[model samples]
Target: MSERLPPNTKIRGTGFNISDFWSWGFSDVLTNSLRGVFAEFLVGSTLDVLQQPRIEWDAYDLMYKDKKIEVKSAAYIQSWHEGQYSKISFGIEAKRAYNYATRSYTPEPVRNADLYVFCLLYEKDANLIDVLNTEQWHFYIVKTNVLNTLFPQQKRISLSTLEKITQPVSFTEIKETIDQAIYQ
Candidate 1:
């Protein structure tokens, strides 16, 4: 009554391969977790930013010299439909306060790190969603204070709006741009 895909067989008629279909079925938690890991790997390898050791809580994801960097990633083609273009947003959360006396967290608007690096995978054609293709990925860097002031009371920002503040940089330019922002 049911049919199963043959081993080592590629599905035809559909634009996506088996892996794409498989990824499409992933839940939001798993999808976001994987995206974060991928972003960390790209930043760590390309910019030579060292990943912080695993901890229960971390304010930042990577360390570059004395500066702390937080990396965020989003792809247009997720586990759902593949549109013509992908729109990505970065979460600019208001800082949380840890009260030593109460042993609880409180809401506060504070800069969590020196810089925020946003990795966006904007596919020219959503049908070709390949993680291995670096050409499809774009990296943008912005100072936390600048973001805090520009997007006050906002929890997220779009790529287009971010470009108005600072132009997107290539992977090779990420380190240099970040250094300039840090020391400036």
Candidate 2:
């Protein structure tokens, strides 16, 4: 375990299962990754075009311009079931990275935004486990309209609808979705 550490890694695995511990850390990694990915897309594809400042709230995994364009990451999951497969919970599993530039802490600023869109990567070919890998990074964007068709159910809900989950996107249908969003 010591050998695996760089030099100042705060984590110590004197007796803990390093592999198992690492698995939990994956959630943190994914959250941050999604934050960065969402921020980049919001700023690059949308804000940059509109000429906005790129500011990221590292602690909250938030980003935007004039502190109005808010961006977030989430996953989607079934909410009307039970058990792990039945009951649905949101955090880091079944959701999408979202951008909320249309709203603000104030009422007027929230309503006056010009172009407001909440984007998701909506991968077609990538897998869930693959995204969890610290090495593999899929920081891309796809339109909400396209994201809907990929999933079997709803399409294009308000950004607030996305789950606040933080787990890696499941590989199941991920690659398939990415392919669809990117190509046809």
Candidate 3:
């Protein structure tokens, strides 16, 4: 039961050349490929847009209203390398979320124009399938950088409360997911 993306699946690349790590100093073809997959589908066809490393914006991806979006693409892997035993990840060297409730994480300088975000492009279907079933697929959304300032921590936060803090196009609630991503 294995299948590949359609020849005309139309996955567009943003031509973004992100480094694997400041330490690695090498561009990762795999990560960029996945990013291309996500960018093509982030808007779900309502608007046709593609994101890449060279979008000519001050950020990563562009939005429906022509807003410049800074994208942080990540792929987490639990494994050990050459001589180290660790569960590492192939990711954009940027943290893509904000928690106004905590203000704990460090991110790029896009607070006002560069909305904090996380774009996860995965090929595995079991983890997240049926919602948007395309290998050339990815999810995009803005995070709540002001949650701590705007929320009551002791209480469970809900999506409706953070509804305003999301991508203008996809409108995906992103902060909580980024939190979960850090731990899970």
Best candidate (score: lDDT):
1
Clashing pairs in 1: none
Q: How accurate locally is residue 47 in candidate 3, as Cα lDDT from 0 to 100?
A: 36
Kindly list the per-residue Cα lDDT of model 3 for residues 1-184, writing each as its tens digit. 1343332443247332232232254223344454443443454233344332333222344454434344454433111113332222222233344544565543643233333344443333333422234343344444334433454232333233334544322224333444343344
* TM-score result, candidate 3: 0.33
Q: Residue 135 error for model 1, in Å?
A: 2.0
Rank order (by TM-score, best first): 1, 3, 2
What C-alpha lDDT do the candidate models reach, one value each? Answer: 0.73, 0.34, 0.37
Worst 10 residues of 1 by lDDT: 49-58
How many residue pairs clash (N, CA or C atoms closer than 3 angstroms) in each of the candidate models, in the order given?
0, 30, 11
How well is each residue in 1-184 modelled by candidate 2, as lDDT tens digits?
Answer: 0133322344464655556555565444335455345434534443233333333432222223333222333333122212232221112212332345643333321122211223333323323423333233222233333333343254233333433311223323333433444454
Off by over 4 Å in 2: 1-29, 32-39, 42-53, 57-73, 77-109, 123-184
Candidates ranked by lDDT: 1, 3, 2
What is the Å distance of residue 56 in model 1 from its true position? 6.3
